[model samples]
Target: MEFINIALSNLPVTPENNQQPSEGMQTGLDLKEKLSEKMKMAVEHDFFAGIYYLQGKYGHTYRELSTSRNLLQQIYREILEYYIDGTWVLLESAAPIILRTQDAKSKHFLQLGFRDLESSRLFHQRGSNIGKKLYTNQINFYKQGIKRVRRARKYGVLAILESRTPVEEKKEYQYVSYDEVRNPSITEDVKEYDRVLNKMIGLISRQLVDATIQSSTRGYPLELDLIEMHQDNFGAIIPDHPHLLNRFLSEVETAKFHERQKLPDRSRPSR
Candidate 1:
């Protein structure tokens, strides 16, 4: 038998500079749009619900609380209406409305009462202890509300900042000191803010690393910086997909191995 020689051409080559992966597959664009619409829904629902609750409509109160599941259901309904022929579907009910409405409405009244207490001279709860009562419950509600609002604003602000800023501009947002020379309080606040923000950054880094490893097999590099910045405030933990990380690591190693094999062997060249 005659020995036949065959030439192999166009061998696959792996690029040396495989960029870092995206932190999040879903950009803040989608989340921000959802949040914008959700805020409208929340404000509307809260406004109406607050009125009805104050009027003792216990049934309506439960429907208006901005819990995660209820908000998600609202979004789901909106999505269905937009994408599925504009027909609305019944969302599954969670807790009984009558009781929740009563409790929530009671809480709503407290917020208004608290706001009133701030300017009033009368002890909110007692004729003689008005100052003390104002100091207690009213102050408590305002402080809690302020904290909640700050947290919400932080999430929205971070999302918008990341979504609009280009990847190359990300370095600017990276860890930076805001030490002001004049104000001790401002310096302390900035330091505390940085501490918490860095923790948030660490969480994002972990998630991005996990995503990158998992997606290597799919031959996609995730936007690590964007992922770090755009991750949900509470969604930093690596996903629980079974074997996803392992599979990605294996794929990356395999790719590296094949890459090494693709190099021309000088010892056997022109044989």
Candidate 2:
């Protein structure tokens, strides 16, 4: 019988130099494109929806809801179409129309109202929430739209900055300064740990996204950011799927364990 040697290459290799795992860079790029488009959708929706809300209120007072929805619907529809298609012509064509048409019902209601407060208020009461359910749909759409926009812009900025200034590998570690100088309390080991940890966190986030895609997972949000990680440069993408997020947390915990074992010990010698 011949003795055969087996390799333990099957085990996950712990990262030495901080870098993204497989498909991490491509995934990050894809995520950035998706986020930017979503942000555009959200912010535009917010703009039209806000204006529509004001117009709708006035229309409600006069009970011209059908006209109000029609007017605002065109604006909302154009805004969405522009967002999806990146067409400036839609905005140009819609702008004057929105300005001219959206407020007409409200103006009519106001002209009717100054003459009689009792009658105006009574009319408003009768028309309360008449178009509200449909109106609320627009409001909800705007709210979520803005949230997604904010989230995307945050990550988009981060990705932009990261692309511009890639982190250089350093033989000598750096430290966080208080005001302008380093704090005495923060030891060298802690500083090194922080550097490694931060880099690992960024990598783990990209990998988490890749893993989620690989799993072909469902039960995630329309466009969930698996990382749920945010920075000044990288805006917040709130966790949409707990299961996907857990994978990232798992990577972080593993890194922490390895760092504790590998890095220099932080302790004081008794005098």
Candidate 3:
């Protein structure tokens, strides 16, 4: 996906202070710009990692993918800090786009990693000459990859939800007077972006449900448990389908019952 370039220059300066931005404001803008560049670099790394994986260069693939994940994590941390520190005002209308893009890129990479591992496993399975030790290592990698993907997906969902919520401007940021361009086109763009994001969230939630069900059916209790744990974090945003919603609630109750069963009976005196 292409990075949405935010036109920070287009932000209208307040009429009362038409002069150039203060040094502090300029520094904030520069930091935002640098963060944008970092996000672009992260996307580039993901692209290159995919290319390397397809070419069977496992070493290059691992390095690029690792770098991309690390860059994304750093960007997330910095963005959170900016929000907390009231510097997100300088980001203007670009904040939502940045958050959404980060979440989307994370989901994309997780799927890519899982797909690559599955393909490799199938290929090895078809080859009679594959060493047992090598095959065992591949299985181990695949299991670890699944855990990583699930964790990444959980984080991505949280990030996207954060984008959906409104951020209140801090009192300290009130001194910086600027208005976002009120163009109808920009307003429409935001609406469209929001619609797409909401759709994506619904899809992701359904996918999680499907995964949980599949894992349970396949008797992968550990995977099912992990997904259930993740599902609880964002269950509020699950799609509004009645059947799906009911099923999810039922599963939650079942999970709770199992937990209760495992707990010691406090009502009885200790042995």
Candidate 4:
């Protein structure tokens, strides 16, 4: 709520004062993509936590799956609300979207506001062991967590296909291509999206930290060192899904390699 307020207050009143087309378009695209990814992460975490909540409710897993499936029914309703509701609306609206649909009983309203906690059940069943090679000791159930998040993302995207919202209700305004770049308000308004993403990440990060401290995860060995050892003993796994680009692994490997180089050759036995 505070995030929504700050974003609304900070937008440029007019596009004339902002950058020219190309630069603004690029910025808009970059922010749009980044915001979507952050939204995905937050929404996935929401679903994961919500599964725990439902389990507490003695909620039906099948019921949750059905609810997730039915969410598509409210997609346009959510889309309308998304455009009209907050800082994003300021790109065209002189005023923020006046939200009238706030019934707790309404599925549409629930999905929009409480998406993460209200989505499908977590870990419907034990999934395959994809991350086993990524570990060296007991096969960690972290892969189960990963699988749950993937399922959450699937459910969320199925419910809400588009990350972007329309700037206006008119036919031409239905879709604003980044290439059609006429709005400078887009640049300023999107900074709000960036902040919103940061807030979501912060929220998830803190929740994860708390969960770790409270759970068996606190006793679990650091997976980084385990992964490093596995990569050392077995060589690197070809395509680790999350590290498909391998940027992090390369840096870790280089650091360890240099550290090893600094050590005297123990192969000489007695010096």
Scored by TM-score, the top model is 3
Ranking by TM-score: 3, 2, 1, 4
The weakest ten consecutive residues by lDDT in model 2 span 1-10
TM-score between model 1 and native? 0.24
Where does candidate 1 have its weakest 10-residue lDDT segment?
1-10
Residue-level lDDT of model 3, residues 174-202, one tens digit each, is 44434433332243445533553454456
Per-residue alpha-carbon lDDT of candidate 2 for residues 1-271, written as tens digits (9 for 90 to 100): 0000000011122234876544433433443344334333333333344444665655333333443343333333322322222112211222343345444433333323222323323333333334554643553343333233333333332332233222352223354468546445564555533453365466556552121212112222122122332321122222231222223223333333234337566698658
- After the best TM-score superposition of candidate 3, give how far the Cα of residue 99 lies from its true spot, in angstroms: 34
Taking the tens digit of each residue's C-alpha lDDT, what string does model 4 give over 1-271?
1222121122112235665534333433443344333333333333433564656743444443334323321221222222222211111121112123232222242244334222211221221223322221111222233223323322222222112222252235476678676553444445533443343345345442111111112222111111111122122232222321223223323343245337677876785
TM-score on alpha carbons, each prediction: 0.24, 0.24, 0.28, 0.20
lDDT of 1 by residue, 193-235 (tens): 4554664456455552121211222233212222322222222
Q: Residue 259 of model 2: what lDDT?
A: 48
Local accuracy by lDDT, each model: 0.32, 0.32, 0.39, 0.28
Evaluated at residue 224, the lDDT of candidate 3 is 21
lDDT at residue 5 of model 2 (Cα atoms): 4
Candidate 2 achieves a global lDDT of 0.32
lDDT of 3 at 123: 36
